[model samples]
Target: MRFSLLLMVCALCSVSQAALTFILGAHENVCFGVFTDQPRTSISYYFAVQSGGAFDVDYTIKNPRGEVIVTEDKQRQGDFIINADIAGEYELCFSNSMSTYAEKVIDFEIKVENDKNDFKANMPDQPNAKPKAHIENMGKTVDKIDQKLDELLRAIQYYKTRNNRNQATVKSTESRIYYFSIFEVLLMVGMAGLQITVVQLFFKGSRKQLV
Candidate 1:
């Protein structure tokens, strides 16, 4: 039963979906192009800067006509769904040019679904009213379930990203603290040695003067 449910989830979620995690070097910009031959398709794009510098990046989305559909500057994460009214290639871009030395880890996903066609194909004309109603009801139920599953999947991704970022931060902090403590200890030891040397010199000079 669990295996079947997992399969169902995969089938529902695998509609032209791309999930990726990659490092964007400083002063580098990358763009991904998605081609859709059919018009009126739904496109879902999501991105998050997992770690680095300010945990932000510049991003832009453009239509096939070379027109900007959406653009953002120094953003940490975003989730957007836009309709592709014109059938062609769409571009999604990410830029890390703001950071000169730090590299950013980004997690993103893009999904394209022909929502209208899929629904219409699934629901066909039935001569028997009872069967038609039953089929329609089943389709609705399936759609609802699919939507809930998608939401759950997105939530899981979000938490996973957050966990990775937090872990990185904790490790960085630990390293800094460890090095700082060592430096502090060495400074204290050096100060003590200098004081001892000065005291010995003062005593020697006083003895010489007494003699």
Candidate 2:
């Protein structure tokens, strides 16, 4: 199991390293192109809005023919795998146009998995290949472990994004409270001064009438 896991990790490191974190400005759009030379390749896409106004973004996936594969509006995060059966460039785009002033911090990953180096492909063609079944079983186990790891990572990212957005909200609330307290204090002081002035004017008028 350990050996299989290691192999899986080693095989995936290059594609996993393509993950990116960046800021998407307000009213701006960003697109990334991924080209596949072979058909029936698996493409995985994942993204989260780590922090920003509403913690949401609009996204679109388009194929080489300019046809939309998927489109979403105001989504906080998504994970999707699509088969790119047509050999060409696929476009993934993120748009913050709905946000007039708030910018977004986005974390996203795109992975392309091809079957050219599949373990099954390298197996011997003999009808009674002794190690074929063992190898296939090992591969299946490794795949299951890999899928679990992906789910765990996605959960972690989701929590992290929520934490960041919550912290931002808390800080904003604290600031508003601070400024409001100052305004309240100023208003109280002004009211007290006005009351004192009114009392003094009333007493002065009463004394003049008595004289």
Candidate 3:
């Protein structure tokens, strides 16, 4: 009975450790990759100046497409709240983009939070999780390559979507200009006819006086 209870406790701990964390040194940037069967619900983040930070920092979140989802500037240590409507692995970036000449040590924390308590509870108990790693560095390399390829595909799709929207906007603007030019030409013709009628009326009055 005790052994069964011990296994359950370990399983719970493993579920929590499933999250990944990273630290960025001063003037340094990094990328993180994520794999999830369930959708990610939120990004819980924190930032601090481990040393020599009297100024603010700039940070942003990027999707695989290199599109920025969220940004914060002149920010200090605090909790920034966010929600992802779609569930996938996302990137959190801290930029020294605004750091002054002085090399400042900035510390940031990121946790990929998922709120699937119901799903986690229903997770099949892994009684045989025996350090699942092989000596194949080649396999790891191949896996990394595959992951990169997937990201590239997603990025291309995102940019293509944006390009299509821009093209649509240009076409709409062209249509509007084309219509406006026609309208302006018609208005000018009407004004010219009005001027000719006024001149003829003025001459008829002089002819009647001569008669």
Model 1 lDDT tens row, 1-211: 0000011112234257777788899999888877776677788888888899878999989998999999999998999898988888788888998899999999878888765546556655667556766767887898799899989988987898788789888999999999999999999999999999999999999999999
Q: Using alpha carbons, what is the TM-score of model 3?
A: 0.40
Residue range with the least summed lDDT across 10 consecutive positions in model 1: 1-10
Residue-level lDDT tens digits of model 3 in 122-192: 65657754433442455468758965974685466445545654665677799999999999999999999
Global lDDT scores for all candidate models: 0.80, 0.80, 0.52
Error of 3 at 145 (Å): 41
In model 1, the clashing pairs are: none
For candidate 3, give the lDDT of residue 60: 71
Off by over 4 Å in 1: 1-15, 115-130
TM, every model: 0.82, 0.83, 0.40
Q: Highest TM-score, which number?
A: 2
- Residue 32 of model 3: what lDDT? 45
